[model samples]
Target: MSTTTQTAYLYKHAHPFLPRTIKAASGIWLTLENGQKILDATGGAAVTAIGHGDLRVKEAIIAQLDKVAYCHPGFYQTDIAQDLATFLVSTTHGRMARALLTGSGSEAVEAAMKLARQYFLEQSPPQKSRHHFIARQGSWHGCTIATLAMGDFKVRKAIFEPILPENVSRVSACNSYRGMREGETTEAYVARLAQELDDEFQRIGPDNVCAFIAEPISGSPLGCMPSVPGYFTAVKAICDRYGALLIFDEVMVGMGRTGTLHAWEQEDVVPDIQVIGKALGAGYIPISAVLANERVISAFKNGSKYFVHGQTYQSHPAACAAALQVQRIVQSDGLLDNVRNMGMYLEQSLRGRLAKHPHVGNIRGRGLFWGIEFVANKGTKAPLDPSLKVADRIHQKGMSEGYDIAIFQATGSAEGGWNGDHILLAPPYIVTKSDVDEITDRVCRVVEDVFTELQERGDIREVDSRVESRKTM
Candidate 1:
């Protein structure tokens, strides 16, 4: 394969420059066409939990293919799908009563949205008014139009705003880093965010809202920011008061990425509907799931006895088989413990290396999932100009020849502003201390070198001065 700008594959950005071609991947590393090795750091958007090229997962998938590759959900029930759903529900300790498999995270989220709506309809009174969803600013649910309406990432949602649904509205994200007032206690911050959520429900009319969706620990759009203590407890209470379901979009943070099987497990709250993917199959196959708790399941069981949504690949045999084996491996290998242990080391290493850096505003996340927010001014927390593309530049530097590592670069800003330029560093749950050290070393070098080049070009001084001037203004 040759790197070429001209290709039949229509690229996401359609860049004029040619893209690097990966020849193969294995064991937390990628080999390019030229045979250069690159650290598979972000696990291709935090999907690879067991690392690259695990033989066990491959064997499981091959076995699944041999048994059965494709089966229509409406026609027959696959034992593999049943086994995987059972495994998923068992992991949730029966909190989620059933799992509906889907093709990707977007499909899972869309399924969750539909389930939430179907839940309201299943009620005795049939709450037809409960059609709207309330999601947080800077929160990302998925890429579909309904999910986009629920999500507030301006970069992705801006283009199709005119066509997106009106049933979804936004509230401020429970980001103590961004929304918390100076000198405010964590309790106070949590209360304020809860009140804001409540107010949004009132504004939208409590009966008109079906659910309030959020990520337990934010994903790409929010830079792995977890809410302060007691935040979800308060939000749950408000959701209950309004009779709206609480939906947790754990697509990126769940499945052992955040040290726990489910991110909500850390939050002390069980959502009515949960969306998860990315780490489900550990990148061995494409799979995502919408998990419905007992409350929602019971509602459907008594009413229509059916969920209104259906996907072509829902409950796919091969996908579920791949996921089941991945989950078993995660448990068999005790990788969640590794995640916690290695997560601590990764956190320590990153903070020790980058915490005091002038551009690093915040380093927050749990377990193996971590993120570093870049800013022009530390004290004021003013974001570097979007034009600076600090995170993108660092990503480019990391993927370059000398420093060969791949990271998930992201921006999380309210209303398309130039605020949250950050990069997520979620190594696989199987990463070791050595892996953490090397990942950190290369990551630090990338950030340091990118800024150094910017400084040499006098860009850092100008950004700092411009942000400082605005602070005064």
Candidate 2:
């Protein structure tokens, strides 16, 4: 078969320009069909935790296939699924009592929304008025309609606004770098954000709010920004006072990506509901889950005892087996400790290399997850025009020869819905010191070269001047 013909049949994510064709992937590297090797940074949207090809996960899947692969989730119970649920619950240390396995992060988020609504419905007093959800301004929950409505990622949500639910509202994201004002202490910043949330609840009528949803560490939409100290505690307090559930979407940062097994562990507050994915199955299979706290679970148990939600592949045996083995490997190998140690090294390397760069506005993250936001003016933190596509250029440059690295790119942070760029780097947890060094060096080179090329062509000076003009005005 002809190469062009082979590529022509598959529908690509982007149009006019086809993505690189991967021949094979193994251990943090992807080999293209043309024999170019690309380092798998960002882990394909922070999904590949243990790396590309692990024999253990493959063997576990095979073993499950030998037993039974398919079963109706509503009719029969699978032991592998049960064990996987138990393992996930155990990680929460009794904070969460039940796990509803879903096909992807979007499904899990949808489930969380439904579960939150159901919990209120099942309550003794039946607060059916609680139908609204409050999410942060710069957030990316998922791509589905309901999840998109809950998220304020402008690029994806703007066109669908007319069709999306109006029940979701937004507040400022807890991004100290961009959201915090000058001369403001971290305590003051936290207090301000908390008050904004409280005011929002009051405006909406506390009884009308079903939950307040947020990512423990802001993901792509906010450039991997972690909240300031006491942020989560304050937000949780507001939710508690309003009789609303707190839902943490750990889909991108959970399951050992953030140096801890769960990102919430370091936040000093436990969520009433949690959505976990990506690293759970380690990119070996499609899997995600929504965990319900004891309070929410008990309400259902005492009332209807039915979730009213089920997917055809909800508890597929093979997926559960794959994820179970992935978790087992994470625990037995003590990868979380490695994540902590290597995370410090990665942060140090990034700061040392990019902190003083004119275009690099901020570098923030935890564990293996990090994001470098780009700006036209570092002092003013003015975002480059979205048309420049700074992050996308860096990502493309990294894939080119002499710098074969894969990094995640995102925009829409400078403003709530648009006008910012950032590159997210989330290497595999199995990365070593040498690996970190190489990845950092390659990423630094790509960022420098892309900006250098843009400057040589006078592309950036125009954007910077425009931003400066806007700021002065």
Reference-based lDDT, each prediction: 0.87, 0.91
Looking at model 1, residue 235 earns an lDDT score of 91
lDDT of 2 at 107: 94
Q: Output the lDDT of residue 265, model 1.
A: 88
What tens digits encode model 2's per-residue C-alpha lDDT throughout 1-473?
Answer: 46576556666443344567899999999999889999998899999999988999999999999999899999999999999999999988888899999889999999999999999999887999999999999999999999999987887777677899999998999988888898999999999999999999999999999999999998888889998889999999999998999999999999999999999999999999999999999989999999989999999999998888888999889999999999999999889999999999999999999999999999999999999999988888888876678889998888899999998998877865467899899999999999999999999999999999988988884254334322221
Per residue, candidate 1 scores C-alpha lDDT tens digits across 391-438 of 899898899899999988998542233355899998888888999999
Model 2 regions more than 4 Å off: 1-17, 462-473
Cα RMSD (Å) between model 2 and the true structure?
2.7
Candidate 2 TM-score over all chains jointly = 0.96
Mark the regions of model 1 whose C-alpha exceeds 4 Å error after superposition.
Answer: 2-6, 15-17, 413-417, 461-473
User: In model 1, how large is the Cα lDDT of residue 69?
Assistant: 95
Each model's RMSD to truth, in Å? 3.0, 2.7
